[model samples]
Target chain A: AQSVTQPDIHITVSEGASLELRCNYSYGATPYLFWYVQSPGQGLQLLLKYFSGDTLVQGIKGFEAEFKRSQSSFNLRKPSVHWSDAAEYFCAVVFNQAGTALIFGKGTTLSVSS
Target chain B: DARVTQTPRHKVTEMGQEVTMRCQPILGHNTVFWYRQTMMQGLELLAYFRNRAPLDDSGMPKDRFSAEMPDATLATLKIQPSEPRDSAVYFCASGPGRTNGETQYFGPGTRLLVL
Candidate 1:
């Protein structure tokens, strides 16, 4: 079975500051990775995902993640975070095979200060 | 801009009462998934369906939980004799591909509270 672990439970950043959220996964082989964000009273929104190809994948809202097979990690990053970026973030892993369900991390709450 | 839709954004009921939640997946999407979110658990997959057929439901409690997709667009999850421990935010998501890399669009979760 696959599982995900997010070391940070919460992170606080000032506006315009860079941010990085760490995520690690345990899977037999290379797995699909994704980052999602959920604002208050809203559904989760996909930040980005990694299947194959370039190690660094860019996503919506200026978010990006690097897939490090050696580290078993897919860490989300943003050079400059906006106040609206405050939300709960989740990291998930899915099997390479089709139609597999995702195993999600516990989630990290992001608090942005102006 | 098609998106998944869920009914009864908020549901409150007494213990032992029956509660049902509904979902409408995006058009042309073949997969639908149900997830539960709480402060303690974060998010947990409860069930999923493909082609209007249940594909996995191992996360759901057999005794009190049931999930069904009666048609292409409609999916429902029901809990009988609810308990306070069951209180959480229930989310419905759908996607176009069966592959692992497919993006799933989520609907605003339904908040269920059992008193």
Candidate 2:
């Protein structure tokens, strides 16, 4: 079945450490990729999205993601992680077409240590 | 900024009880979606509507789950005789349209607990 997969279920990083959350998808068509962050008891907020544009996309909160067509991956990165960045991160792909309902992966939880 | 809103932030109920959750999509949005989040299943799309019309609901249980867009502002999900397995956070999302960079805006989910 075509699906989105987040390789790491949980990741721990020291404050100020760099962060990378991997997202891989199995799809045949050109995909629109997205990254979203959700804090505890809060709704999901869009981090960044990759449409038909420059492969590297920047989003709010100093987050960025790269869309690598060769790997079918859209990995999220942050140069310096902060304590507030500890949250559940989900990678999504528009199931069909450019903009439509998204298929989300099992999220990766980020734990920040002091 | 405008945001999607959901009603009854939290609810605790017994098994076999009826449960209803409501959502108010952002104004001028033409698409609405309902999703359920569980540890076992992750986030699953339950149903969606386009311009008050049901587009797809294959993810929802036909026997017990029902979703409707009563108006432009209101969308509802009702489960009759809900079970403990139905306990999860239900989220509502909306977009300006189906295509053309219309990304979804999610609401703070309604947390439902069925004993």
Candidate 3:
């Protein structure tokens, strides 16, 4: 079974500082990776996704992720952190060969300090 | 805005009661998914459908849980004799289906509490 690992349970960053959330997945084949953000009492919002090619994908709210096949990682990064970006972020993988269901990580909570 | 919508944003039920949660997928979306989120289980896929037909529901507890799409726009996840362990936020998502890199748009979850 394919699973996602988000090493950081919670991360605190000063406003305007750079932020990075690490994610690693265990999959035997080429992995389909994604990042999503959820605010309190809100639905999960797509941040970005990586299927193939380019290796780098840009997403909404100035977020981006790099897919490293060798490292088995797709880490979400933002050059500057905004207070609004403080939310729970999830990393997910699609293992469609087995089933079309998505497997998600435990999630990393981001806190921005002013 | 062509987004998924879930009804009864909040539901409180007693144990052993029947609970039904509903979802309206984005128009034109061919794939719909049901997911449950809790503090212990971050997010789990319970079931999914394509073109109003169930494709996979392996994540669901078959004995107590049932999922169905009565029509193209509606999907339902029902729990019979609900338990406290079932307390969680149930989410519905929709996608284009059968393609790589397809994004799933999630609805505001229905928060359920089984007391």
* Poorest 10 consecutive residues by lDDT, candidate 3 chain B: B95-104
Better model by DockQ: candidate 1 vs candidate 3: 1
Model 1 ranges off by over 4 Å: none
Question: Per DockQ, what order, best first?
Answer: 1, 3, 2
DockQ-derived CAPRI band for the predicted complex in model 1: medium
DockQ of each: 0.72, 0.67, 0.69
lDDT of 2 by residue, B1-115 (tens): 9999999999999999999999999999999999999999999999999999998899999999999999999999999999999999999999988475468999999999999
**Mind giving the per-residue lDDT tens digits that candidate 2 earns over A1-114?**
679999999999999999999999998876788899999999899999998879999999999999998999999999999999999999998867744778999999999999
User: Which ranges in model 2 have alpha carbons more than 4 Å from their true place?
Assistant: B98-101
User: Given the true complex, what DockQ would model 2 score?
Assistant: 0.67
What candidate 3 gets wrong by more than 4 Å, as runs, is A97-99
The CA lDDT of each predicted structure is: 0.92, 0.93, 0.92
Report the number of clashing residue pairs per model: 0, 0, 0
Fnat, one value per model = 0.64, 0.62, 0.71
| Residue B5 shift from truth in candidate 1, angstroms | 0.5
lDDT of 1 by residue, A3-109 (tens): 89999999999999999999999887898899999999899999999989999999999999999999999999999999999999999877656665777899999
By DockQ, the best candidate is 1
